[model samples]
Target chain A: MSGSSPGSIERLLGEREIVIACGPGGVGKTTTAAAAAAIAASRLGGDVLVLTVDPARRLADALGLKGLGNQVTPVPPEVFQAAGETPLGTLSAAMLDTKQSWDALIGEHAPDEATRDRILHNPLYQNITERFIQSHDYIAMERLYELHSSGSWDLIVVDTPPTRNALDFLDAPARLADFFSSRLLRWLIAPSRSTLLGIASKPFTQVADRILGTQFLADITEFFVSLQSMYDGFVERANAVSRLLADERTSFMVVSTSETVPLREAEFFATELATRGLDIGAVVLNKVLPTSLSDPDALAATRRLAQRTPEMTAALAARLDVDASVLDRVLETVTESFEDFAVVARREASSRERFPLGGATLLTVPQLDRDVHDMEGLLTLGSYLLGS
Target chain B: MIPLAERSLIFVTGKGGVGKTSVAAGLAQMLAFQGRSVLGCEVDAKGDLAAAFEAPPSGFTPVSAGENLSLMAMDTEASLREYLKLNLKIPIIGRIGPLARAFDFVATAAPGVKEILTVGKLCYEVRERHYDTVVVDASATGHIVGQLAAPQAINELVKVGLIRSQTDWMLDILSDPRQCGLVIVTTPEEMPVAETVELAAKVAEETTVELAAVVVNRVLPERFSPRAEAVFDRLSSHEGIDALSEVLGADSASVVGAAALATTMRRSRVQHMNTLRAGLPAGTPLVLVPYLFQRADGHRATRQLALHLAEEIDR
Candidate 1:
């Protein structure tokens, strides 16, 4: 991994159990993670699974999975063979259906038929189940742990959400556990124990009569009323998920660009992971600008050409178009704008240089000329990841 | 051509999270104080505009935060609901609420859909002339590109309808330099500075809207004098160390910190002003806002920002 070149991010996938890829939106985390998995499975002949939580389904499309759900879909043998230079190993992929997972969790936890139906059918519950708050994240974690424990794959690569909120996906199990264990849930379910409710006699009996005018609040109360029976069960599951995350085998990777915001986010996330006592294995900086020019002489020539724009403009106007004033004006503008052009070109060159962030073994990948859309692109990315 | 007074929409957008909302609210407050009608719009779901005005999170409905400025959250749900009803020809039955909610859910769920909704709402406000100015706290560079591109996306996705027509109208407004302009906000940091340059190029390629100005915010104070560095160096030397250590031992960390602070300040100031100069077209004014000790959250801070903006605009 240390010997990996300036342009690629290498992975010792045989050694590590879990690899988490995280970064800000549009930084190519999904593609990078997929490529790494592809590399591991192809080059190393190790079974690999890539799990993506991005609702965008970019990874699903990249993997050529028709419709990805909670269930793992094995990549076609040919696809894996094509992606690797050597005989490829097995590849499986899944896109997490957070909502479906939540429903399944509830069904497993519900105390009775009435409670299960009440919880499952509620609109607010459905909405929240899909939202950031619910155990969608916890469920995803549980699925990852299940896959890892099953020994079905040698390497499991997880592509997390793009925003700073990606941390929430990892932290969700503990958060849900805290929410369940907190006094708030108890107060919501058994209002008799609540101090404020104790002051107001017949609180549970008068719940409906207290506030009916506000339709939104009433709708919310009704939604919770139906979900109450399964509350304790949900809490217990959340606790189990939290313990699963506490396992030492899982490692968090902070994915970022060389740019400030993503790098800053990675730094902040590192601090957060440290606070949570989670071990951060590595930091992968994707889409890093290359330091050296492909053609320094050509670049210098362009700089000179930009400087002698006036002569170029005169020559262009004389030969190309006498009557085309617009063309002549454009030529003249270009001639005068050579210095500005040189500045831009220089900046573009400098932007490629390594952005040194100390205390992290940074793996930087060069900016891709094309967008990642299919298995071929992922393969090319995989080669680059290993080569670099 | 409509008179300046009648051309009531002032759409303010720049690179994301660069205090565009603060600038918008400040501008609105200034305009409102001058007895002009103003509405501050937060097209982004983050609702930073409302935060700037110290107003409660709101949606669609403009809530007055002050005498002149009213803040609106621009509810994407409501916008999607109305859009579906009018454009998609969805029936307004109670059952449609679920469908509408689904659409809202899908729209929110879609990558860059929030941006589309934000721009859509903003364009609607502009076209309707709802206020004297609709200063949109738009999404940052990449997102704003998506926002501006949404009309074309919708135009291509939806063949012919009010949505298409509305999208067309918004595109016109966005593309017309006279009607709308893009104001870029940047900090002195390398990434933001670099992003600003890239964003300017991208925006120029996509739209005819003029680059109004680059607002360089939170510029640190220049504290290092030429003599101060020499004095500090001399004090640290062995010849002056005994006397200096007695006098400045406790304040050494502060001095070093101050020195580092000065270096950072100088670097930032130079980088910011240089980036602004380099990125912006020549003669495009660069507004430098001094760093405030406190966060720009409260009304007092916003008012100060407004005053600073007024000064910059005048200059």
Candidate 2:
């Protein structure tokens, strides 16, 4: 969907069915996803769904989520109306419950009720779903695929997991596919015998048995053996998920703050997406200092006021009907604070100029003084996000 | 709450991108600069250790970072190999390849196999007195409790094994507050504060490790007193700006506006900080690290932050 066209985030949201919002953590990725989805539904007119990882408590309430679940809940129409936006379409939000999602996938792909019950009840099933780091990534991908294929929502914006490595979710599907087909996995599930394959896996089992104890090994073996029954279903679903990522109907919006660390990570992720021929719809930078702070004349005036604070305090105090001592302190702080922020603003401007966008549209949101919690706050952010 | 430098092992964790690595690096550097031999390990192995120190890349093997700081990344495979060499007395050179592959597979499949190795290595360093202190840039809050509780989880899962036998000492070290502690770093913001509070609760509930301190990083300076604040509020308006422009011969609105923004940001952050303090346990030492408007996330920032942390500690 992203090519040689006049592509803003508004167009990207309208055009693509899937928009993957991913970047370094703690940079408002989840909030941005929610905002983008809210804006799309309000402006572009569709049933937009935001699949967020973890939202702030108030934000969850704003979306009408009482507690955690995989159920997609619709944001009340009155919530949007309160924000002064009459949505043309419905907005829905779903928190990605990793454990429940894995259970649901097994429910869908299980060969029968007996196998499903066995796999679900197995102790290793709980451990693997909860402890396996990559399990969340794979399930997130699969859930997106399932939701898209079900034709439930017109647009889906996904807030990716906060992975230590940025590429984990992107590579999760192919990696899972390969893992399912791995020779080692096949060997693990095969019945023990004197066959050549069995003999090769014997030493591994013995070593593992010695280290982990035979009971744990047996538990692992039984779990995997049960999981082997659904191997064909998992691999086909994984492949489909991988294809969905690369499809033209999907787009990626890489998000980050203007801070050095998160921005650098985001640029690397953006570059990796392009290297893999993925469409980068837009590179959104959040919490950028306002450009007005960087005005040269403003910096000069602040310096002049700071230096002349003592001389002008009395007269200025009289004119403004304030105490001279308080005015003096206020003048000093005001000027010094302005100078301090100017340095940061100018530095941010330089980083903005230096960031490599390739061909993706660049969107920036200023550093709002207040935290975004309710729909009103989100709409305030969404206005900036839509570049209105 | 033991002082940061006094703890034999300190796991530094926070929400991602809140300067966790830099704070870890700063704590290690500060201790090392104080003439204590320190070992710093990056648990996630994201190469942030090297970035924070501006040093060469580190590996499982320790490399000299400065006067007394040795930096390395946490590699469970290497830790497993070392454990076998010490405990089992296995030569393990040629045999370790396939053995490590199998172990890696098991580690991937099992719940606490990999995490125990990470915690075990740090605990081993502490017990052996290889360094005065070991600083770990541990996983973020989401994964930290799981990582720190690895020994307990292992004890639950593995009833009998070499790994089971090793859990006793790791648990002892983790259970002793004087030996091991957790330092959580956060900026005064909504999500980070919420996560920090939750992590503190989880640590108390699940792990034996003590919450040593909460370091609030990137706190903006508040320059306006109540009276000065009232004075500035007037200056932020249209009529007051005209008066300021008459005095300075230039429109002071932008400067005044920028200052107002900074003040407003700090004011809102004060509310979040109050909520954070309330959610945390009473008497928990709250260290404030002032925001740096200059360079960021580099060696220079690390040094500046280290100095700021020292001043806070001294106070």
Candidate 3:
């Protein structure tokens, strides 16, 4: 085991009731969340749930959530046993199904069944729930809120949606609440409710009508009117979800690769999270090259091996039972490959140095030789995460 | 399908962190290097496009990147203003702040209104034939479908309006393979390749834009032949390492380890490559860009990728 444990991460998983893994897309944030939850459940001995979005297929099967929906499925202990381990506690997972979550929200908040059905059947409603990029963010946070409030699990590790702006999901709840309670939305639903605002938005509507047409306006207006019944419920729940994120029990873990772009975005996200009074518990850098790649001795040795003098090539060939010419070529390829990867590893090292971690704990996971697609893979990754 | 570079407009997209902006800039740079006037537009205003060109940040007004390359960042607000001035003949554009807010309201409530502005602006440049090829650093895969299909969505939602009339020409350009196409950029990895394969299917089904080609970026090169690999496996033993250390007068473990790393990385990624090849339409052009060990940043790496792309397209 690596003795230099990322102690803060271990402490974070053990102590915080909620850990939200967020950062730029394709940086293994989803895997990081699952590994942390799996490790915490196995080590800390408590019920833990990882709410993920679009896990790799094999990983989903490993988690017993191949066709995940809103319902949480417990990962059977037999699956962990197959991975050659025993679970100390339950580990469950649920994938974020945005459309289903939206329908459920409407079902819960609508004034009556008829209103709910009308809103659900609206084409615009379906489009907004299904295609509105921001809605996914809002729904993920809302789902987290509902799960946290249920009091069933000791810890919940949530993987945020990959947003266009890394900060979009952070503001989604507040934005949704503001949109639902806005005077414009109110005026759109029923202009007579506010004469002053209605008079103000009239010319605006005239221009909009000319551009969007009366039919589009009527369709949109009808949709908003149908949604009016759920206004208060949405506002209250959204604000609650927003507040829940900032609660003391929750912490944010920003995940990124050591590559410059993702690292820069993760730093910005961490800074933004801090500026918003959210606690950044740790930053996990995944798929980092080995430090030895940049070692001076290794670099010098590769440089020497690159020459492939006749004496060295013949000796290497005899030792390896290959022809001298083939050995010469192999040595050349190895040296060239080493030097090439060394450049990237050094770049990663310098980028890691420049990361502005502030007070957050830093954790780095070396690049694995293969894709992590099974429970054993997850646990191996989890062990690296735990430094156990 | 039309050759990728022959298309009048190309929207380069992929999962985030997969070098979509770099590919778009590289493709545009390649065209510019060929003496064809090119415009590169960043759809999300991320500034990474400008960084790819090693130029200043772009805006609604195009910034000249080099000889024949000009880069612009898409601004939906600016696009809306331009639309109003040209289409609505609105003289008081400066004073339409309240109306803009109303537009914002509808754009939020209705999904495709904002997307149309982004697409409409790009299609406008194509329609004007202002540039030989206009390459767009478009939204990530998650949102590109919504953006590409925005015109159709508007057609369905709006019965009669100025926007209603705008979708026809855009659709004509987008649906024609020779005029407009989409290039999906991906690395040979699980999530990216999976996303690419899925997105190709979605593009075929949901949007009218032609899939010009697939650019597999950062494909790790195999440095060893089969016989050489067998030799390497034997040489990796401790006895061979001791002999190697004696010859080199230093530890050769990492030097050898780097090769092992390369081999395994290449081996794993080959599966993704095969998966990608098997999943695409029978004849989709697959372009490969080698992994750059040098920092993949600025104009130098962009040029290297462009050169690689040139070779692939010619082949």
Candidate 4:
């Protein structure tokens, strides 16, 4: 892909209202998404906001900020300036706290003041809302919709949870919603009613039964009874969150390493996204080994040394013995491994060749020597994002 | 020499993203080659173990990666379902499929339940004697500690019956130095070596499993000697140096680069080895594996790793 051209990824970003970057852990999704947003904001002269749900708070660290909560914070203009780029546009970022988001969601969805007070105050409700239902992976779409609906920026970029199946993050809102809407909630609530009725009708009998046998089960049943009202409220909010995620404004950008497992995950996540009618803007294959060797003569000399050194030659022979192939075959295999990796790189380059969305574009970032840690790394990534 | 038949559970763990899965696969293959029935288990949900065995991603069922080596990728859902069936005595899981699925999902939603379920399943495999040797490609250091400590964690939560009994038994086995062995794998780099030392200390404090040995993989071989350096220097300034220089220019850089890398690597490796030697017991051995030029993928690379491991284990 030409550095100057609007690659498939760039176009996709330009056209989509929301871009979700998803991948496995430690694959540079956060940095990549941040860079992409920075690129769109600076190069395209569009307003961009990047939202990240990783609890590690690494995104803010990457962007050279103190901390980010639910509110959008403008990235320092000096960061882009340091990278030799004038800030021709604006970029903002926010780190989503799932617990805070859940609390906000409850406050927004509560039916009445008394209901809200009762629900929010209940320990059971707090557990379900703050702990059980507040996972970043499950609430990604909620954050996306929250950012999208604000109308605060022209484009929104979301850094998804780290998982092999990126679509799982996309599917979480709906899955949680389904759990609440399903009959399981009724079952959870039922025992409470039965216990209350039994208390009203024959308290002594039930109490004696509990004391005589099944004491553990009785305690568990009592705990479930206390949680009934909160469970109902949780179900209602989960439904609302699910509906917002299934909307068409959302697009997925799968980030992965060129390694087999990561690529396979990308393929799987892509298929899952397609099944859910979510548009896969592009597959951002990260950490691809450069196709052209920096120096070829060095490779030939190393090959010659392998042929000449007794110890090295012995190691090579031992390696060949396990595989049991002829010299020609061994050379062919070695060549093919390199060629296959190049093919993967080419495929990634071509896949992002054209942005499917009219105004959006695709882009590629070459592999770097070190992991992205501080602001300098993010700036390096940012430069790559701008196709520098 | 210790007979291969007596070895029961081989717990292989390393720093995250190292070739732990590959090492586990090679170990299983080597054991299988010696006619031992082996089961290779990967606790991570990435299902790379299935990929190694060339099996589809539905990973509950064990698939044969080789003649006597079988691979199983632990699925959180399947494990939860089985746990519910066994613990709650809910037989018709299909009839209440939604509830079953919900329970499975909710159970995993709890903080450390997933780790517990994974480790619980592995313990089941070990206790059942389904394989003569079970190799666990456990989670990274932090997660592995939580995983191995699950039995104790669950013991505190659930007080009676099979779960408690099983937890007790598992803890007993893990805490016994003779029954279970913990092999810490590391690269000859500073961070991984540091992490390995910390992990070993943590394991020592929390559990009774013996620190069998440390496997330092991916060490750069020493490539230059004093004589060779002098010869290369002379060649650089010799009368016919220009022609030879043109031919060997890139090689010179490569050699220099390799030498520099080796020097730094050797220094760090020796420092780590010394630290480990001082910290660990007197008898605990350290094994160093040279970095293979090839990537750790496919059966060929796995076999090569097995050969390297054979030397280490034999010692």
**What DockQ does every candidate get?**
0.03, 0.73, 0.79, 0.15
Q: Model 2, range B118-166, lDDT digits (tens) per residue?
A: 9999999999999999999999888898899989988888888788888
Shift in Å, residue B235, candidate 4? 11
- TM-score of the candidate numbered 3? 0.97
Candidate 4 lDDT, tens digit per residue, A74-173?
8888777776677667888888776677667666666566656665665434444443323666656676766676787888888875443445666676
Question: What value does the TM-score of chain B take for model 4?
Answer: 0.84
lDDT for residue A257 in candidate 1, whole number 0-100: 65
Residue pairs clashing, model 2: none
Instruction: Tell me the deviation in Å of residue A43 in model 2.
Output: 1.0
lDDT of 4 by residue, B111-199 (tens): 34566677777777778888888877777664566667666765654445454555767777676655567778777544466567778
Residue-wise lDDT of candidate 1 within A1-388, one digit each (tens)? Answer: 2244453334445567787776555456777788778777777677889987652344466576666578888888776556444545877888877787777777777778777888777655654554333345567776776677788878899887433255767767666666555444444446533443342343322321221112323334455555566667766666666665656656666666654334545666777777777766666766543332223442443344334445443543344323234433432232233323233334433332433333434566655644465677777777766664
Model 1 RMSD, rounded to 1 decimal: 16.8
Could you give the CAPRI-style class of model 1? incorrect
Off by over 4 Å in 2: A1-7, A191-201
**Clash count for each candidate, listed in order shown:** 6, 0, 0, 13
What's the candidate order when arranged by decreasing lDDT? Answer: 3, 2, 4, 1
How close is every model to the real structure, measured as TM-score?
A: 0.54, 0.96, 0.97, 0.70
lDDT of 2 by residue, A100-167 (tens): 99998899889999999999998778877887667888888888988899898999999998786889
Model 3: per-residue Cα lDDT over A1-388, one tens digit each:
1234454478888888999999999899888889899888887879999999888787787788968588899988888888888888889999999999999989999889999999899878888998878999999999999999999999999999988898998899999889988888876677734442353357767777778887777667778888887888888998999999999999999999988778888888988998999999888899988888988889889888986589988877786678888778878888888989999988888887788777788888889988887788888888877766
RMSD of each: 16.8, 2.6, 2.1, 8.5
Candidate 4 chain A weakest lDDT stretch, 10 residues: A204-213
TM-score of 1: 0.54
